[model samples]
Structure formats: C-alpha cells, structure tokens
Target chain A: MSMLPRRVEFHEEGPREGFQMEKGTYPLDDRLALIDALAASGLRQVQCASFVSPRAVPQMADSPELFARLRKRPGTRYTGLWLNESGFERARACDNIDIDGKVVFYVTEPFSQRNNNCSVAENRERQLAWIDRYIALGIPFEQAYVVTAFGCNLGGPVPVSAVTDVVRWLVDACADRRIRFPAFYLADTMGWANPEEIKRRIGAVRELVPQARIGLHLHDTRGVGGANVYAAMQMGVDLFDSSVAGLGGCPFAGHKHGGAAGNICTEDMAFMCEEMGVDTGLDLEQLVEAARLAERIIGRPLNGRLMRSGTLAAMRC
Target chain B: MSMLPRRVEFHEEGPREGFQMEKGTYPLDDRLALIDALAASGLRQVQCASFVSPRAVPQMADSPELFARLRKRPGTRYTGLWLNESGFERARACDNIDIDGKVVFYVTEPFSQRNNNCSVAENRERQLAWIDRYIALGIPFEQAYVVTAFGCNLGGPVPVSAVTDVVRWLVDACADRRIRFPAFYLADTMGWANPEEIKRRIGAVRELVPQARIGLHLHDTRGVGGANVYAAMQMGVDLFDSSVAGLGGCPFAGHKHGGAAGNICTEDMAFMCEEMGVDTGLDLEQLVEAARLAERIIGRPLNGRLMRSGTLAAMRC
Candidate 1:
C-alpha cells in the first residue's frame, strides 16, 4: 500500500464557499441553522464566511451579521476569509470569528488578474505592503493561499516552480519578521489537477517548507476529486478542505469556470476516510444530516452521492 | 507516486446495467441509439443487454429484440449477459452477442439466493454440470464473476478466504479441464468496499491466481467508487466495469437494500483515467453526450458528475 497518514483533518467550508456559489441568498436564520448543525457534526474547524464586497459576492454580504449570530462551539475553530483591507477590518471587528489574514497569490498572471483584478506581481507587492497593518491588528500574516497552485482557467498549466517560489518567499518573509506559520494551502481553484500533478506539486511544496503542514483544497469538476484525495493521502497529506453536499464555485469564474464543480463533498470525504481506517473524528450520520439540511436551505440537490446512497456503516447498522 | 498501469480497459455496461435499474423501460430504438453513440465514442467493448427472465427483470425483457436491431460497429466487441441455460442459448442464437458462460459463485449464501435465487453450492454445482454443454456449443467458459465478492446485503461481511477459495477453485478446475481462463471479476455488489478492503482483496486474489487477470466491478453506493478505482490502479489492477451516467443497481436488492447508489460512472471513470494520464481510449465529450441521451431516455437525471461538470480536457481545450 502507498504511504498514508493514520488520521486526517477535514475542515468544513460549506457555510462560506458552498453558500457563496448559490444563485439565491438563503435567509440569515437558515444559514445560521446550517452552521450550527455542521458544528454539531464533530468537525474541528468551520469556515463561516468571507468578508468580501457585497457588490462582488452578494451571498457573503451578511458575514459580519452571521458571525455575530454564530453560536461558537467549544473546541471548534471558526474562521472567516478576508481578501482585502476592508474585509480584514470587518473580520477583525467580528465577535466570534477568527481571521486567517492569509495573503492570497495566484500562481498564474491571467487568473490573478481575472479573479482578483490584479497581476501576480502586483498582488505580491500589495500583500507585502499590508503585512505591517495586518500584524498591528493582531492578525497573523504567516500563512498564505497559493490559488490556482495546480492550474488556471486562462493559462492552462501553472508551473510547479512558480508555486514553490511563492512558498519560499513566504517562508523567508516570515523568518525575517520571526513569525510562525502552522500550515499553507494549495488551492486547486479551477479543479484542473490530476494525481500526477498533485504528487509533483505537493512534493515540491514539502521540499520548500518541511516543517509546515500541507493541505489540499480539491474540486470535483472532472469527477476525479475522490481519486485525487486518495492520491494525496498516499502521499501523506492529512489536511483537506471540503464543503457540505459538495457545494461551492467561483462567482467571478461562474459555475463552469475552469470546469469547477464544487469543493470535494465533506460527507463523501469523511466516508472515504472512515472506511479506509483513517479516523476523522466525525459522525458520518450527523454529517449526512447536515448535508440534507444544506440541500433544504439551498432549495436544490447538492452534488454529494453519499446522501442519496447512504454509508456502508449505516447499512450494516 | 504509486505504481500504476499505462493503459486501462473500460468496458461500458451502461446500456445493460444502467437501463435495467431505471423504473422506466426505455424504448428499444432509444437504447440502440445510445449504444451506437457509445460505440462511436471509441469504447472498445460494450455490454449491450442481459438476457434474463422477463418476469424477473422486465426492463431487460426486450434483450432479444434489442440485440437483433443493434447497429454493430466494426472493431467493437458487443457482449450479452446470461444467468441460466436458457439465457445462454438465447445469446448463442444471436448474431453479434458474445457470452462468457460465466459460472457465478457468490461469496455469501444469502446474496446468492436473494440475487440469483440459488444458494452458492447449488449454483456452483449447476454451473459445473453445464460446463461441458457450454464448451460443446463453442461458448468459452473463460471467465467467471464472483458476485458480492466485497460484501453482501443479507450476509454482511464476506470473508477474504471465501473470495480466494472461489478463485482458486476456478483456477484449478480450468487447469484440470485444459481451459485458459483469462480473468475473473470481483463485484462489489453492495459497494461495501474501501481502499484498504480493495488492497486486501485484490492482493489475495493475485497471490492465488498468479497468471489470471483480475478486474473490479465497483458500485458507487457509498461514494468511494472513484477512490476504490484509484486504490485498485495503485495495485496494478486496470480492468473496470462502468456504466454510462452511473446508472445501475441490483433490482433484487433495490436502491436502498445494499446501499446501492449506482454503478461506477463510465464518463466519470474515463475522465479520471484521462486526467491521470492513464489512457482509456475514449472520447469524454461523446460519453457525456451519451449520458445526456440516457438521461432523456430514462426521463430522469443520472448519477454521473462529469456530465454536469464537464471534463478537464474539454475545459483546457
């Protein structure tokens, strides 16, 4: 068997990424209810919302209000996504939310411009400039999100060297400022990566940052999402980002942008792990219930298969 | 990276298996049209229909008529499924249908009785009695299918020894009879398999039948269908049975009986193989078109993801 970790950490991104892709904005109470249900499902971390512009992503306009209403579960981490200074300020002002203060950099120039309205070079310069203010707000600028780390929509293949260079730069900057980063995420933003590409890129990232935990945010766009996860597990990657019921997509890119389907289904991922003897510290049944609730809240069938089929454990029971 | 095969053979079983699961019996002309489209999409082999009892499976009652009207594609192999002597005789009467004379022995007794209406020992005895007759008719008994090789709905956990014993019996019987059996398939009829289970079972089968090619016929009951494929591929097992649009379930067990979701989707499987540089020699776009046609014919949406999300290759193009 390929080498694998005995345990995996699945961080739920449904309340944030899954909701943001919806064409209709769910009621605030409904959204809060879904998050509470997810928290009860034994997930250690939940990405609650993104504090982006309401004009850009209307679905996330209520992030501050939602954060205030969030009943934070003990021993559970609740984080909010922040892209700009305004978003970070709003996140910092929230009562029950934790901010990652991640400086996002796209691996390709076209995706950086198309998705973020900035070039790769300009985004890097801007992020470096914001480090002092972000640090002053008691937010750590240690970790980074290498968006399109595998490939991009406009430019097909994002070079492995480019991703590693960004990681190395982050490491050097952190060392210069004496900041510690626990982990970094390689986001397959467009869901274009294969197992070979995953191995290549994850290997490169590990070589650059030997001490930091590596995570993968995979998409099921091409139907290889689970296969890609298996390959990453074989490579000893234990951190994954998934959304309930397989919800989420890029608003700028649209549903079909870069063939993005949704984030890997959280229930599906947890099912895979539990079946393979990898403890995820989750209740599969509760996750399935949460997924069903998510479907009701969204008023559409989610992309996940386990909800329809049921788990083997459940069947045996 | 884990060791993998350079090429994989994906046999399309959608028309046969996918259609049989639907509540609606698709018109013969529509079934023929979907099969023709699938053949044109570069799939080398397609299982067109099963010649089962009309009373048992009404959806497959038109097997004879469908086989008669099929537009045979040059260089493509078309096969039919048979369970008893009558079904085998019907397949032989057809012009283009190929029969495996597969003598099935379920790993668990309850599944054998529930699915095939015969106990494991009785089925084995009956199949052994028909071997001479099957060979005399020039229908090679070259392969067998071990139904519920992974687990059974009624019997729960099937032992690894039960599966290997069956394979060893086949190997010995074939060697004694001077017959060359090319392969045997391990069917996860209930889809109760994980990567670990796949590794364990496929490893045991290989150790016993050193020269025989091993194949996996996986279902998507618990959503690890793609993950199971990846695990098998890492173990150097490449042959898979997939239905277009992921349409299939054991009618005897029903959709919820054994946690049956559907078959491993053909388009989704082809997409995964293509993304990982494993050649399946199939046009994904044509497969997607076939899936759409299937959905229309069935008057319901199929379970495939690639149809909704499109392929990464198409996205790149």
Candidate 2:
C-alpha cells in the first residue's frame, strides 16, 4: 500500500480552537491580525471564532465583534463554531463568515458532562434539533465534528461502535432534515489516539458511512499527531484541522500529566505533507512567519518546531 | 510498500551526545547515575561518553574515570564516540565499551570545516588513518557515520553522490584492511533531510553496496524525525541512533531562530514502532523514567514528548 496521499487540505483553527485555551483574552485587533495572517498564508479554510457563551469561554467573548470587524479576504473560506441555536444565530449575524452550520457533538457521556454539562444522549438530541433548525434557516451544514470520537479523559475507552453509532445517527438526522453531502470530523478532543486506533476508527466510520465526507481534527498531545495523520492518509484521508504555532488546547484538554498543547501545528502538518510529496498548496515559509507572529502576540514561544527549524525545501530554497 | 519494519533497534546516546551540549558539567556521580539508569532501562546499545579533549568538551572530561566506575550490565552493549585516533585510543582504554570502533566523517565541505575545523578531504584522510589504527589494534570497525549525508546547514545541499561516495570509500577501505561486514549510518547532521532525501540517499547506498548494513541517525529539528524514520523503515532500515529525552544538538546545531534540540526521543521512536506493531525489545516505561531523571538532572524540561504524555502501551499497562 502507498504510505501517503498525493494531496491534502487543512482547516486553520488558530483563531478559534487555538485561542480558546489561552489564559488571557487577546485584543480584537490581534485576533483580526492573526486571521489576516492566516489568510495571507494561503489557508483556504479559516475557522475564525466560536459563538459560544462568553461566560463559559471568556477568551472568545468578542467573536461576533471580531467577525464584524474582520476584512474578508478574497478566495478564503471563513467559518465559525456553533453548538446551539443562539450560537448559530450569532454566527449568522456576522457578514464575515461564509459558512454557517458548524456543530460539535460529544460522543461520550463523560466528555459531554464535563465540557457541555450534559449527558451524551442529551447532547445527541440537542445536535439533532440544531441540525433541523440549521436546515430550516437554509444554511448548509459545514461539518459535524464528533468530539472525543477516539476516547475521553473522564469517559475512557470509547469503543469504535460508540463512535460509528454517533456517525450513523447523525447520518439519519441529516437525512431527516433532507440534508445531503454530509461531512463529519473525528475530533480527538484529548489527543488520545495512536496510529492503530486512528486506522481502526477511520475504518469503522468508512464502513458505516461510505458516502459521508470524513476529516480528522487531531491533537498532538501524545506527539503522535503526525504519525496518526500519516496513518489516516494511508487509509485515504486528506482533510484535517490544524492550528498555527500549534496553539490552543482547552484547559480541560490537559491530561493528568502534560497538556496536549494545541492542534497539530499547521506548518508542521503542511511540511510533512509537502515532504511526503503530497501537495498542500500552502506557503510554508509564510505559515512559519505567521506562527512567529502568533508567538509575538502571545508573548511566549509556542509548541511548533517548524517555525523554529524551517522546512528542508525552504532551507534549500 | 509496508510503512514499517517488524523489529527496530535504537542506540542510546543521551549519556554521550545529550550531555555534550549542556552548559554545565554534570558531576561524575550524576553522570554515572544517568548511565546506570539507562543500563537498567533495557537499552541494548548505550553510547556512554566521548573521549574528546576536556578543553574542548569539558562535560565529557571525566570519560575515562566514569568508564572505569560503571557497573557494566549484561545483555547490554556499551559504546563511545571517537572522532580520531586519540579519541579511539581513549575508548580502547575503557573496559566498559563493547564495540571497538566508532567514527564520524563529514560528507559535505561546509559541515566538515565548521564542525571538525578541517576540510572534507582532511576529515576523510583522518577517518581512514583512524580505521587503520583501529584495524592494527585488532578492534573490529563498527559504524562509519556519514555526517551531512542528507544536507548541511552551511552547505545548502548534499547530493546523493556525496553520500554514496563516502559510503563506497568506507566499504573499500574496510575491504582493503580485510575488514568484513561494515556498517554505515546516514546522519542528517543538521536535520536537513526530508522523506524524499532519506529515500533517495538510502536507495543510492543500497544500490551501491547491497551487502552493507545501513542505519539512520535522524534529528527531529524539522519535526519530521518520526516521518523520516517511517520512510527509512519502508526502505528496510531498522537501526537508528537516538538520545533519551531527545537531548543534544552540538552547541553548533542551533540555528538563529531556535535551538535544534537532540535526536529523536528514544521513547517516541520506540512508541511509534510499538504502535505500528513492531517490536523494539525495549522497556518503554523504564526509558521514560530515565528521561524524567535526565530532565531532573538537567533541572529543566527536555525535548521528549513521550515522557510528558505517556505512551499508549504504558498507559494501558
């Protein structure tokens, strides 16, 4: 079997997922600057912000305001995170966002209770309701990110069946709403995935819903983020969620030992794909500069290595 | 092609290369303690120390004394670094070392001049002289590490022919000395190798000398260390040189942007192999603890991720 794919695409989450975990709230100007930097770096999809309750996620309290102020860059796709009707309406109110329906549903009880303050079954019902509401509003669903699809911190050992069960249910819900071309993401919320586990889970999801577009939202908590991506690519996966400077992991994402800091570094992932002869269509040198800008904004070094030591291609160039 | 090997082996260099770049000299007791910890951690090949001059590498100044004090463990092989005949003589004087010859030669002019303070030709001549001295002493020559086999920081690009030339010269020299079964290592000294470079060089070496055993000494500076290892394994390489807690970078290894910290983390390498269903014959948990101890001794966090985020096997165990 081929060890890699010919091409890959990434959704930049630095402004949304990356900023969510920071201790201090970045000024709206800095957030817009990061989004602009990502746009200039050739990232097609940028998850700009989450319209979550400001009280729960104080870091993103100004999501709507930031979205209002962000100068939409041409040729760039912008989206926002939404978990409920209120969040969806907030995202819809913004002119900057090009995509509206972004939903996160927990696959396990412990994670649902811990992060959402609800049980898994309740979260599933709420997700269905939101899907119907989104369809009623004529908004095409972007992606239904299945949070903690691999495993959870409090609810450990999430079986493959549990994950596929959620996917199958989501498919049924989408059909009920007459929504076609559904896309789902397997989010390793805690970064608790190995290559075998990634292959097994992705295989199970494919077997159950072959028609659904699948993507991975991986965390580098265990440092296997790249390996897991390679494994997924070998199984024909190409779409992924990453953050520049590898920024952000919800404070809750911290393990008993160390924080699974940030999503897989965007530049690192792009560099890996580029090195494997996979076309990423990203300006990696610019991405590295963006990561540096992020570090300057955060006033501390982030967890990305590529920003520090550049790509071989860039070095040779 | 299969993405991995069935069995992979690692030569631990935390005690040697890891310490060489540290700012303060670790007291002899601390050094001995780390070695003992490594010995107990089930590493088969532990690179103990370098016999370089104290004036140059004060961290390794007490190599002979430390070697004399080590309680050698059975089932574990010990080795030391030797850049020339004088360093080889010092290693020869030690009773702890199992493999008799260890040599590092540069394949690029920039690295040879910058690192060794000599031209590539001069370094090659000295390597041959050292090999003759080793053969005269009846010491079996082990691995001839081809530094900058992939690319160099100062030297923009190292052609595959440069790598194959050095490997071919080392093979012919061994034959002329009546030495058999020579081993060669493709060292990405500046971490300048990508997956393609690794494949091209290793493929070239295999075509030129199919009988020669090949290994990789990779650096994770570019975050592709694991990817490079996977790429090499797909081409049939199973032996690697790594440092515990991913330590070392030859104070010269740091770039203007970031310090290129050490080799691939030993536990990360083992974890990747183990996750892919390959047997590393290592006690990964013990190795992680050894890394922790190294961190404690260094009084700072090391570059390893597995130590911070426990491995899947260890977590399950």
Candidate 3:
C-alpha cells in the first residue's frame, strides 16, 4: 500500500525504557497515565510494558497491572518485550489477550543475555517458542523484531556487514515460521550513531533485506539523532521507532552524555516529519500535551525541544 | 575571488571577539599570552583586540600593548577593532608598524547607538571622516572595515534590499575611494541567521558586493552554526570571523538561549575545513592549547568541542 504508508510507531519504553533508568521508583499510575496519553496520540505500536523480572528492572515490577489498566486504542498494537522464557510466559498470562488486535515481542542480543542471564541464542529460542502461543490465540505475531541491531556502545561501532548479517540471520531463523519474515530494526542503544554511520549502515541493511521493512530506533545522546533521521530518510529508510517526549532509556547503559540517554522523542520525530513533508497523521499540539504528561510521569523534564517550544511557526501564531 | 569559497574560514574570537564581551577585565599579559596560541594556529586575520576606550571595553583596555606582545607571523595581520571617532583616534596612536603592522577601524551601528549613543549614519559619517584622517596621517586606512552590515539581533532582520542599499550607500559615500571597498563583512549581531538564511544573505551579498572583499561574522547561539558554515562555504563565501573556543558576543547576550552565547570556534571550523579538503593551514593541537588558555582567562570551561576532542583521525587511530 504505497510502500506501507509513511507511518510513525510510538515505542513507549518508559516502563522498560524510562523506569529502568531512574534511581527512584516511578509510581505505577504515573506510568499508566502517560501510556494512556501516548496511545491517544494516534501512535500505532507501543512497547507498552516489558515482562522482565523486578530484580533486573525493579522499576517495572508492576508490568502485569500496568498492562491491565491500559486503555487500548483501536488499530493499535501492544508489544510486551521479553528477555527470556519467563518474561514471555509472564507476558502471555497477563490479563489482556487480544492486545487490542495486535501483538509482538522483542529483545536485544547481548543486552538480553546479560540482563536476563541467558545467551542471545537462548533468548531467541525462548521468544520463538512464544510465537505459537500468540498464533494459537488468534493474534498477529509481529515477527521477532530484534533491538540494538545497530551496535552496542560499550562494544563500539558495529560493522555495517555485521548489521546486514543480523538481518539475514533473523529472516533465515524465522523462514520456517507461519509469521511473516521477521523485520529487522536498528536501535542506537547508547545514542552513538551519527549521520554518516546511519547512512552507511542503513545502506547495508537495504542491501541485505531489500523486500523487508527496516526501522530505525535512534537516540539523541549526541544531538545528531534528529539529523540522523533526516540522513536515513535521504537513504530511503522511513520506518522509525520513537518514545514520547524522549521519556525512556536503558539506565544501566550510561548517562545522557557519556552514559546512556533517552531515545529521540516522538514529538520531535513528528516535528521533523512535519518539516520534511512526511505525514504521520499526528496532532502535534495533542502530541506535545502527551509529552508533557510523560515528563510528569517520570518527574523529570524531557530532552525534546518540540514539546517545550512547539514548532517555531506555532509560537509566532 | 572566483566565487565565495564554500569552505568557511574560521576566526578564533577569544582575545577580541570573546573577551570584549567579558565583564571582568583580563590582564594585558593574560590576554597577550592567550593570543599567542591562537596566532600559532595559522589564523591569518585575527581580531586581536579592540581599540575602544578603557571605560567602554575594559577587557580590551590595553589593545596597544596586547598587540606589542603578539609574535607576528609573516602572513598574519593582527587587527585591533575600533568602534567610533574616538576609537579611530586611539587606532592611530596604537598602530605599531613593527609589531601589529596596520590599524583598521570598524563599529556596529546598532551597538554604537546602544553602547556608544550614536546613530548608524552618524557613526558612518564619523568613520568616513576618520578614514581620511588616517590617510592623511599616512597610516594605512585601507584595511579598515565595518560589522553588523547585514542584520542585527536587537535591530531585527533587515531586508536584503535594505542591506544592499546600505552597502551601496556606504560604498557610494566612500566616493569610490581606493580604500573605500574595505572588506564588507556580515555579522549576526544577535546570532539569528540559520543555514538557509546564511546561504541566502551571503550569496546575495556576493552578488551585490561583487568586487568588495566579503567576510562573515557569526555567533553560534543556535546549534546550527556548523551546518550554516557548510552552507556559507558552499556558496563560495571564504573569509569568516570566529572566536577561539567559541568566545564571542556581549556577555549579557549569553544569558539568553538565542543570544550570541557561542562564536564559531576556530578549531572546529578548521576541522570542518580539513574534512572538506579545504586549505586552512591551522595547527589544531596548538589551537586546542589556545582554547585552553582562553578558558583559563574567562575562568569557565569554553564550549568548543575541537579544543577538547583531539583530531578526528587521531581518535580512530
């Protein structure tokens, strides 16, 4: 359909992406309220909550209840990211079965292995085992989407050929499954990817998976994240993964500058899209309001500017 | 000469552009020593110090002595800026034929009114008067120029037509004098020009001032300074005015987000030049050392990245 309508996928990782990062516990409702607004912002897909254990991401202790209170939007899909067998089973048992018409699962390779006490192989195998459960429940099992596919910051710049290899590996691994060929997504797990790197690797991915969808999950750690989106778009990569108001990151990865930082904010993405003539059917004013809610949920100001200043044009009006 | 060089020339603004904005007065030796490092970095034309009154520019009170201490390079020309009639008088007395070489006079119209209590036309009248006197005194008045010719922040954006009109007015007012076509430079008095604007105005200036030596004076309030430099250089505008470690603007301007908080750092501009294969012939390590000295004089960390991060290839090595 016109190469899959230029759509924006809001990945609300605040539960897993945001809370796992904070030194303090964000009350459950604080996150739920934010998720409710995010869903209303016309975002199609969201990593609503993760099914990891409390000890690992103690801030996400209430993933089950967090899902229970979620106000599912029509045409929206909720993905419960799992790092291991237990997280998958826990996610399966959670109160919502339909997931408002869509379901998917994701895990980062080395991060999953280290965080969940399992190898990348073990994590993939366990996640594959849960696909049938999703299929049997009459739900769409969005192929096993992998995260941190770009490179780990701790490990250094990932080779472009290595990224292409990951896409082929995922596609081949799921070749026999009933689910569609698993899509490959790249995440700047530590916000390290700049414009040049984005172009080089995005080109590598296209070469490896010409028919498959490629999503970019960029972080604004170096201030090049937004610009990287523009660069990737120039290279014909459109689908991107974003968090609202930049409300989330892996706390253990590092701080914002030298340490781990938040992903490029959804509103900022929408703003960038608006500027570049890409349409995501989002209400920017409403989206900004949603971002403000997210900032309050985490009790910290966000890194995004579009939310704070709105568009420069809007301010003049 | 052929066209404005797309490769922007970066001017280190530490001693003149940076410190003139500093509220606290720096010692003559501290200022001179800081400039020594900048000089070694191969900046051919440095705004070494201002020839304004001590009451007006206390930080630059000893411009003459500061010039005396500078280790003059063969190709380098140290320019001590002058703001008004009184400044030109001071410029003649401070002209050190042996060390500083020549005396150049310039002033900002908007700032002269705001800071010096004179109208722009009045200031120009004063400049025309002084250019003749400098000629009469046999001091090379040919090197003198003006700033804030394009637009001003507090004065707001001037119509390009108006700017051209002013240039024609300034040029026509010079009676086509041999030195009448002194370098016509554009300044971002409040750091407001974007990349697109830089391209539009600077390109327009190239067309209008076809034979006048053109240069750019930028303040990096917005983060788009580097990109703007790329745009300006691509348009063939060669000469640029920058501050070492991005020291620039009125200190009061730094208190605002859109003020002249940062000047284009000479080191960063050099890096851009190196990447783009332009010949700047700057010694970056010495520039970094210059940045450090500027930081110490200001008693705060300077914000230019090149001064802190070593060579681009150096890290990869």
Candidate with the greatest TM-score versus the true structure: 1
Backbone clashes for every candidate come to 1, 1, 18
DockQ of candidate model 3? 0.11
Across B109-227, the per-residue lDDT of candidate 2 in tens digits comes to 76678778999889888888877776777777777888877777677788878887887787778777778746789888777777666777888989988977799998887677776
Instruction: Determine which window of 10 residues in candidate 3 chain A has minimal summed lDDT.
Output: A97-106
Colliding pairs, model 2: B247-B262
Can you give the DockQ of every candidate in the order shown?
A: 0.52, 0.44, 0.11
* Candidate topping lDDT: 1
Write model 3 residue lDDT over B145-247, tens digit each, in one string: 3444434544544566655655676667566666556666677654445555666776676676687766677655434455456556656777777888778
Question: lDDT per model, in order?
Answer: 0.82, 0.80, 0.61
Error of 3 at A113 (Å): 9.7
After TM-score superposition, what is the CA distance of residue B297 in candidate 1 from its true location, in Å? 2.3
Task: Calculate each model's fnat, 2 decimals.
Answer: 0.56, 0.38, 0.00
Best by DockQ: 1
Model 1, A1-317: lDDT tens digits are 55679999998999998888776788999989988889898999899999899998898998889999999888688998877778878888999997666677777878878777988888888877777676777867645778888887678877899999888888887787777864788888877777777888888889877888888888887677888898889878999999988888543354442224689999998998988889999999889889988988887556777776776774465
Give the winner by DockQ: 2 or 3. Answer: 2
